[model samples]
Target: MKKLLLGSMLVLGATSFGAVVEDLQNNGAKPAVLNIRVKGTVVDPTKYSLIVKPLDATNTTDTMQFNFDGLTIGEEQIVEGGYSAGVYQNNILITDDYKIETSLKRNGQNATTSEYDQMAAAKLAYSLGEPQAVGREYRGKVNVKATGKAKGSFVDNGVNLEVLVKNI
Candidate 1:
């Protein structure tokens, strides 16, 4: 009787341990939510046009890119330096010489901007453009593009620009 009781206790303990391990594994599989803010100034509004769209628009089967699934862009807000009558419409910000900013949120928080360069470098990429086989629809990353009036026109990415506007 004593040996039988010991064996039962061991089985119960192992089952409890397995349950804890499973819980941890499931929790780790959950996705994270991320919020990305992009802000920049247009040095020459007349010379450049900006477009914002989903990252999947740039995807190709030939090239691997970051999985930007679950990203959505908010409205672009003109911070300063624009004409008094400037406006944003059709996912395009129409304004003259302005500082602009936009926000992108992902998954509830699955991806982040910091992970962009790393994932791109690692080649562990996926596209959220099409619906997944699992019947999940994801809102993916925002693609912000700036094009100049002339062909091959140059525009700065604004990684090192100073504070041009404030108070708004």
Candidate 2:
């Protein structure tokens, strides 16, 4: 009975050590900061407004497959005009400023001016983390919703959209 107990202890110890080793070997390096960028356009700004949100947004059931780093991440499908949304992951880090910048252009002109108040309302609806080191790396998500209405006819590329993730 004593010999059996000792053998059991040795087997358990070996199994635990093996697991630790396997984890260490399989643990690839994660990015210290992930820069996510979403770029798309709204076809007819006058007829429809652009709505951008996370795939896992509350009460959100529509989702499209998005490929990120070879992994399939859920994407929120844009139901408006010819607008398609996607998330792009960048391993680079933004050290200077930490903020969401939105740019809208119609016919190669800035659409965020007071002349385009409705378009200027475009903003970051949800942001996960701040630009600060709280003793650990920051990991979260951001959602940008650019809403606007242009006074013009339907052009194939009526509005241009650009959303950049500086820090988090």
Candidate 3:
């Protein structure tokens, strides 16, 4: 069982820290930060499942996926896919930050968990880089509801999950 638990931790850890944010402080640009808060019901509160998609003004075909398959539910989750610097800087981030659509599932069947809040969500703190007048924008937004034609992607059996996005 130790191996199984260890493996789970490794996977979760990788999702939280994939690549370091780029350093653009010399260019007079400030690093961008995103604060994601989630609430409502889910399949397994103890399990974490998420997806991050980069957004750009003109381009809409870039996305990155991560698996946080251990953290519990109803808490604030902090995900830093990479880093950003300027707007239309040619090499700026695809989008200002990212949009997350989430759900819960298990054994290919819908599951349920107790209420989750912003405090329980994992925290993804943004590192400083450079300062800029404008940054990327939040694109492709999704709001999980109790009943309104479940939107976004689903996990093992997650069908009633909720999600919220914030740019800080």
Candidate 4:
């Protein structure tokens, strides 16, 4: 009877170990949606155009980027900047690090006066894995030396960038 109990215990232990291994392998192998959104509002959209662009491939790791440099007040237009999510895990899309670079410019001056770069979104996505469903926001503080017609004027102190990751 003692031998029988020992054999049963060993089998049970092996079964539990297999389950743990399976869980580890399937952790990030699920279908998910990684929706990338870049949102900002113009507090004083009087004479300035907020030119925000997703950094070029060199500055980004994920397969997504956008250009919202011509964003107007209350405007939420979608502009694509050559992005593709080719990496997939268990039918879920995988993303790499991403950064958004924004500039504030005087409409008529054709010059950039202020710049902001935010990368919090990319870091968050990578940490959450493939099946993560959450949203994140990053604030970048910027100091701009007044130039062109806006000389001596203070541009906005900072910009808020947001990214959303969800499961499909």
Candidate 5:
């Protein structure tokens, strides 16, 4: 009986040890960020044009290093900028641009010219453009991107960029 109990205990211990070894062999990994983009339009309540572009689209489909200058806006017409998500997690950069509640004033003593950026995942308010000239309102969409490893994880996958105007 003593030998039997010892052998039973040894078998149970072997099974447990094997299970632990199997679990240790199967290590897990973190998924990288998938993708990010920008959407929206540029609005101009000013009397001049602003230079705001989506960085650069040299290859059209190359999701690396966007290079856009400022766009132009004149009179009551609004040139919009829309931002979707990109292949990066820079939504904080987009959110950082919308801390103020009022329209960004151009100049003068009472002019409030505060702005920020937002990360890609953040539900951010689009940039209202930088106020340099007097009486100018420019609108822009901040695009962001996040990279990841897993599938359907909002990480590196498909990407698109079209100048779509919602309300024209």
Candidate 6:
């Protein structure tokens, strides 16, 4: 069992240390800050994992198959694919100066406790980087209510599982 779990960790959460840009389709539902968070010396929440759960106008749930690294928009017109899974890119991080640390957390406990290890949800904290932006669009937000259905691609597609996934 230990070997199996360790192997799984190797496959899923094995990033050295870097940036991770995630793309969630507009008018779609994707969970931010997935199971694993990256550690660094600048910002801890600079990157996050995604889980897309697209929905319809009437609040009906719809799923779509996405390829964050390999799939391109106009590759084909898609309606919904429940069994389909979204794509991901790892260690696609940004540059900063603040000291950052990565760990696991749940509820309100520390990130390394046994309970946090078994918890399903994790939260990441972001700190100020050197030469902070006085006023700019440092943060980005998307609406996942099934509206902006256009082209999609992941950021830094050259990396593993990297995709610029977004609707036009």
90 Cα displacement, candidate 1 (Å): 9.5
Q: Which candidate wins on lDDT?
A: 3
Residue 127 CA displacement from its true place in model 4, Å: 28
Q: lDDT of each prediction vs. the true structure?
A: 0.29, 0.33, 0.34, 0.30, 0.29, 0.28
Candidate 3: count of backbone clashes, pairs at least 3 residues apart or interchain: 23
Candidate 4 has its poorest 10 consecutive residues by lDDT at 120-129
Models 1 onward score TM values of: 0.17, 0.21, 0.20, 0.17, 0.16, 0.15
For this target, which candidate reaches the highest TM-score against the unseen true structure?
2
Residue 8 alpha-carbon offset, candidate 2, angstroms: 75
Residue-level lDDT of model 5, residues 31-120, one tens digit each, is 434345666644443322222334333322323232211112211212233322211122221211221122322232222322222223
Ranking by TM-score, best first?
Answer: 2, 3, 1, 4, 5, 6
lDDT digits (tens) for residues 85-130 of candidate 3: 2222233334445443333333444333322222323322222122
Quote the lDDT for 126 in model 3.
Answer: 21
**lDDT tens readout by residue for model 4, 23-137:** 2245667553445557544344333222222334422443232322222333333322322222233433334343333333333331233222222211111111121212222
Is 3 or 6 the stronger prediction by TM-score?
A: 3
Off by over 4 Å in 2: 1-97, 113-156
31: Cα error in model 3, Å: 41
Please report, as a residue range, the 10-residue window in candidate 3 with the lowest summed lDDT.
141-150
